[model samples]
Target chain A: MSNNLTIALDIMGGDYGPRSSLPAAVEAVNLIDHLTLILCGNERQIRCELKKLDALTHPRILIEHCSEVVNNDDLPSSALRNKKDSSMRISLDLVKSGRAQACVTAGNTGALLAMAHYVLKMLPGVKRPALISTVPTQTPKPVYLLDLGANVTCDSEVLFQFAVMGAVVAEQAQNIDSAKVSLLNMGAEEIKGHESIKEAAKLLQCSEHINYIGYSEGNDIFSGKADVIVCDGFTGNVALKTCEGIAKLIVHKLTKALNKSLFNKFLALLLFPVLKKLYKRVNPDQYNGASLVGLRGIVVKSHGNASKKAFLAAIEEAVREVERQLPEKIRYKFEEIINKNA
Target chain B: MSNNLTIALDIMGGDYGPRSSLPAAVEAVNLIDHLTLILCGNERQIRCELKKLDALTHPRILIEHCSEVVNNDDLPSSALRNKKDSSMRISLDLVKSGRAQACVTAGNTGALLAMAHYVLKMLPGVKRPALISTVPTQTPKPVYLLDLGANVTCDSEVLFQFAVMGAVVAEQAQNIDSAKVSLLNMGAEEIKGHESIKEAAKLLQCSEHINYIGYSEGNDIFSGKADVIVCDGFTGNVALKTCEGIAKLIVHKLTKALNKSLFNKFLALLLFPVLKKLYKRVNPDQYNGASLVGLRGIVVKSHGNASKKAFLAAIEEAVREVERQLPEKIRYKFEEIINKNA
Candidate 1:
């Protein structure tokens, strides 16, 4: 690990713009001793935020101005084609040009991916990049779920590629040895699911590269079962949001229930420590970083409505991925598979 | 409504055989004023269970002996082909022969659907039967989620049919008149999702029969934003199981957290009442019955491992559907569409 670990922050993206990103970047910089930050956005806004922390002239902190910001509603293709001077594009340029080891953005995810793909391009032998995120489980660590929302529509080949890419992340980034890979399906049975998934399953089963486990139903995602679960982006996104919705619904119900009685209020007070711990473990903020896997360089997308803490978590993931040389490992893995096929 | 609304119970089905079904049947009989039950299964086992409940001589309760039982391992085609003497088949026969208005089973869902379809056949214009279940939401009533695990794969036309069927059920059964219908997709935007979903979205949008709201991600399932959600069985099944998994994980984590310390234990005691309500509300058993929709006859599948209370819920759903003439409503809706096309 080098002492010159630099991660770029897209300070002008996300709902809160610089408000959340600036504080979160500072938090990450403070948390990681060897880290330096390249804040790419409007110079005046970045300077004002830095002055709030009284680190305007810090040696490690560098602010690069971009003329425009990529708003959440901006079309990905339009942003890629038109918003060349936007903070999102400029920050990604830092990653593409090797000026920063990694880039983190709490911005429009589609725009970030679109720009990153156009700028950084995919690694050799990789068909497409998948959105990779760590979903919570009963295990000491989280399971890696990929193709969360990047490619809404996918075929068997794309799904197969996701398995290969996800396997690498599960093994290298998550550090799961002999990582068990499973195709996310409607049922665990071999006969279940659609044609593309069935074909993808056959491909995975025959491949010796991955420890291809059998099909995993949605429930299996949080069961602490498979190390990596792959699905077409559509199903994966629905499943991810489904988990969030249920958690939100449960928490909402619990809140309403807890507010009903004095005894319930007392119980909540007594249970605050454990409840807080449980909530923290399941919090979306705790698992906010979603890596743009299959990209040539490290780029992590923070939740659009992320708070400062959540954005900081995304920065942490980017730093970790950069330190591990995630792209290098994925490229090596992809080339290895290609050579084997040849 | 006459006092002759009879329902058939597949007593030999499910894990508990006659244990859960007999009690559930009795509970349904007691709960509904104009209800009778034909307990169809092995004569000796039915008698033993009936004796246990002291229901042997009840005039409204009739026993119809079945020679064979359909095991979960039995293939759907084999169960339909050879298991004619099975309790599941015999129960469907009761519905077909006009001895019962509905059939209830806590058995292999595939076997039940097969036998029910073989004996009853599909309603005109309905291509395939979809499994429908009401998942709890923030709304006063739960939202109807369909294709829980019926059709493994679905085409655009089939998906459109699901929307129609779901809309009818939402209107007549769930009583959401002019139900807001939505296609389950990864993204809400029109350009997002796969070919079939995009096609289905067009069909839904163009059709005036359903109050077709656009695409709904998994979160919207519980947000009470739409009354009915329709998707292919694979995605729907994964989404449904994903909800179950998250709920289980949260409960498991909460249980572990609650037992961590003396303070937590004390809090658990004070929060017992509210926690109990929350648990009851979220329990899978509370949502036991899932209707086998798009079929000509009303059939309800209970969770195979359902408790007496859970099985009772399934029976209650069947009773409600039979009383409301759900099949007739769906048939009329289907025919109306067919006539409009013609």
Candidate 2:
């Protein structure tokens, strides 16, 4: 709604760093008319990249020089304590200070998560922040899966909170009216999974705000059966990464099969575009942004080895979340649940 | 390597009951010369189905004539307690009584797991039985993934035991020596995953028998980086089912794409066989037998909705395990480790 929608970018993050982020920044500004990007990284490098892209003089792009960079191998605690001036931290800080409405990073996930949690903090009545991402399903719409390596182990209440947050995300981000949510379990049976998951299901069932669908198996993740699927970070991470692995395996298998014969080679050429489109649809990296929800402010995480297009997608996701006022909606939903309980 | 190898089949199991199992049994007996199958189900039904295939009077086929059947919705505890005469339990009983070298079933996983554990019991030094299956990887050889909904939660010791068992299966079943074993985690980093996984990594590293390849993320499951990958049942189940789901989605997506236009439809006809082959290779149901290892006798659990070919595949898997003496190998490995620790 605002004319000046500022988002911060951690240009010093990811494997390629400025090589990907700078171009993504330029593309993002060109794509979104009302968007302003605060590039938080090395001043000299940012200017050089911007000048090469012919966006150096662009009024929408602002540079915030940061001296340190968080290495991929750096421990999250060490990154939090030592790398305050790092681009990842600075981008989060911009969000904290209201200089930016949201921040996007293709940085080390642990470092970015720690920095965002430290800088943005949690929303009222939220115990933890979850990494929620839209995964392609069998249906036309993608389903939301949450707690993707945020908190490895969660109790019933934490999972309940995640379900609420996921519902808000699916509803607002996708503009769906009453998003059906489900707990990711070992089986669809009510007696399945760990006690915590079963307890979370009971809690979700009682909540009138959430349209709590029954348990969803991993097979159900991409079946488009539920709008939002909630699980512990470990399970969610495994499921998401398994999706990545399977997509890669499929592409690999299909390529290998197509490369077998001369006639098949001819078929490959004719089918290349369709196959490429299919790969793009299924490839998790192409949909790179996984939002850190339940925080006071928005933070979108791009993949560590994200391409320029993927980084831009992350920026777009942050813009979407910012426009939707994600945190505020989550806060209001939580407040509603709390008041009802009281 | 016995001239007379007998295996029991739970003909009353699965959705189709005798429909699929009868054909699979006929196929298995025809495929393996030394194989003798004890059909455990309703005598009249088995005779009626086998007569259709002209296999009722086959010399190698014998009927056990169990009256009861385990329903899919039956609780594991109740099934184990009440369904003593059920075909699933009778198959396990045949193995326990040394009447059959191995047992194959396409029953309710929970019920089969419970009955198998109850009747066959665990091998000495084995903490728990795990469901291990081969999944197609990028490599020519498929990798073995274990704990597929067998044990919901596993501690360090249980995981360590699973590693030992998984290694035996990968090495013996695939005819590979010193199979590279990896613990499935959220990240390859030592610092990542839950504490149990990290501790399991340490235990695995200390073992001389196991070729312990540190951590493998979910994406590494089918990367062919490790020969055998182990995780707690919940994670393993999700990952395995996720593979099933992805394969279905890919098939669904490709079919929809092919159906789009006349030109695409023409191309689809040529590519149909290749895609079918790819689907068969990747489809978890095709490679349906998930062996319940760490038990005294071999028990291969086929998919509940297994086709005749898939059930035949399970029988073939059981034959392979019987030939290789999988349970004996696992027992010996555990003994070697225990003696070293002592």
Candidate 3:
């Protein structure tokens, strides 16, 4: 591990803005002795939040004031053209300029993708950057799902590349020697899915570097059959959001069931601890960070409506990626593949 | 339904075949006064099951012996050609020949889709049939999601057709006058999804019959924002299966949590009723029927692993569609749209 590391925090991004990011930044700096956070946002607001948290005088914390903040409703294209001084843009710029080893934001996903791509660019031999996150499964270890709304439509080669990048993350991030990678398809049959998927399967099957498994259905995602599940952005986005929706529905139904009567409510108090622990295990907030991998630099995206803990998790994820040298490892893998193919 | 409604049951389909379907068939006929079932499978097994249920001599129940059965692993095209005398095919043929008003099968989905499409054919101007099923939402009424896995990739026109078909099912099935129809996209923005989604949105927006409510994200599916949500089969399949996956995960987690200690186990016993009710409400087994809409005849595809109760629910759903004359209604809607566009 490096003796010292710096990560840029987009404090003005996300729904809670400085309210969530400031506390997370304070907690992060306090937890990691060798860490420094360059807080990117409105200087006055960041300072105010820091003062409220009683961490304004922390030695390792610095603030870089950004004049504009990217709105959730902003178009990615427009945000790229304009909003040059947005907290989101400045955070990526810091990573690009080598002032920070990584960046974390809980901002507009589309805008963040656009700005990060333009600012940091793709790693050599990489077609595109993918949004990768870990989803809880039946086993103790979670499965890594990728292309979560990065490129909406990935062709055969892009999908194969996602498999490679996803494998690297699963291997390095989770310490798996050979992560079993699977292509997410409508069915497990060889003839299922679009032609692109079939072609991608062929590509993955022939790869010596990847421990590629066969296809995985949506239900198999949480079965822990595969260490990494890869799909196009549209499918991945819907799958991830569906998980979020169902979790919410479960919580809602459970709450309603528990609150029906006074006697039941009293019983609920006794059962609350177990339910709370289960909720924490499956909660989307706990798995907040989705890194935009394949970029030249590390960029971890927290949930837009992130809580302080979720944002803090995002920062920790960025630190881990930096320590693992994720981008450099991916670049080397791709280079080896290119050389082998040649 | 009519005074003497006849439906075909594929007793040799699904994982358990007659073990699940025979009991469901017997119960269905006993539950509905005028409903008659033509149970299609091996005569010996059907009679054996019926005798065990003490329904061997029921007047409303009849048996149509089939020599073959469709396996879940069979390819769609091969199943269509090779399994012509299969129980699944005989059931659909009964519907086609006017011997049955509807057909229910807990068989291979791809095979059923292929056979149904080939036998009944599309309603006059409808492009393709879609697998439509209701998903539980926060509101009292569930939303209808279409193209679950029938067509893997839908173009603009096919997606628009799914919207029309989904709306008809939601309107007639749920008795809503103007069911709110929405195009499912990755994001709820104008420029968020693929071009086909945008074009489908334009078509839906201009439709006089459809109460089109712009775009809906995956999270909004369970938010009760739209009564009918339309998407390509790939996306819908992933979303629906993801729902199933999360529900299973929640149940698994809750069961584990409740079984941790003796005190928690006692609490679980006290909490069993409410928890069971919640599980039933969210259980995919309870919502087993997915009708292949936009065809000339009614066809309900139950879960391949449906329990007796779930298979019975599929029978009930098929009866409901037959009574509603869903195909006729869908045909009328498409005719009206064609005339208006002309």
> lDDT per residue, candidate 3, A1-342, as tens digits?
457999999998888999888999999999999999999999998888789899999999999999999999999999999999999999999999999999999999999999999999999989989999999898888899998999899999999999999999999978879999999999999988989899999999998988999999988898999999999999899898888877777778888778989988898888778777777666653456799999999999999888898999999999999999999999999999999999
Cα shift from native, residue A320, model 2 (Å): 1.1
lDDT by residue (tens digit), candidate 3, B139-230: 88889998899988989999999998898899997888999999989998899889999999998888888899999888888889999999
Error of 1 at B85 (Å): 1.5
- How well does candidate 2 match the true structure, expressed as C-alpha RMSD? 1.1
**Candidate rank order under DockQ:** 2, 3, 1
What ranking emerges by TM-score with the best candidate at the front? 2, 3, 1
Candidate 1, residue A103: Cα displacement in angstroms equals 1.0
DockQ of each: 0.74, 0.87, 0.77
Candidate 1 docking quality: incorrect, acceptable, medium or high: medium
Model 2: per-residue Cα lDDT at residue A89: 95
**Model 2 lDDT tens row, B1-342:** 457899999998998889999999999899889999999999998888888899878999999988799999999999989998999999999999999999999999999988888888899988899998888899998988989999999999999999899888888877778999999999877898889999999988887888998999989988999999999999999999888888888888888998899999999999999999888888774456688999999899989888899899999989988989888988898888889889
Best by DockQ: 2
Tell me, by lDDT, which candidate is best.
2
Q: List the candidate 2 regions with Cα displacement exceeding 4 Å.
A: none
Chain B TM per candidate, please? Answer: 0.96, 0.98, 0.98
lDDT tens digits, residues A14-47, model 1?
Answer: 8888899888888777778899999999999889
CAPRI category for model 3: medium
RMSD, every candidate, angstroms: 2.0, 1.1, 1.3
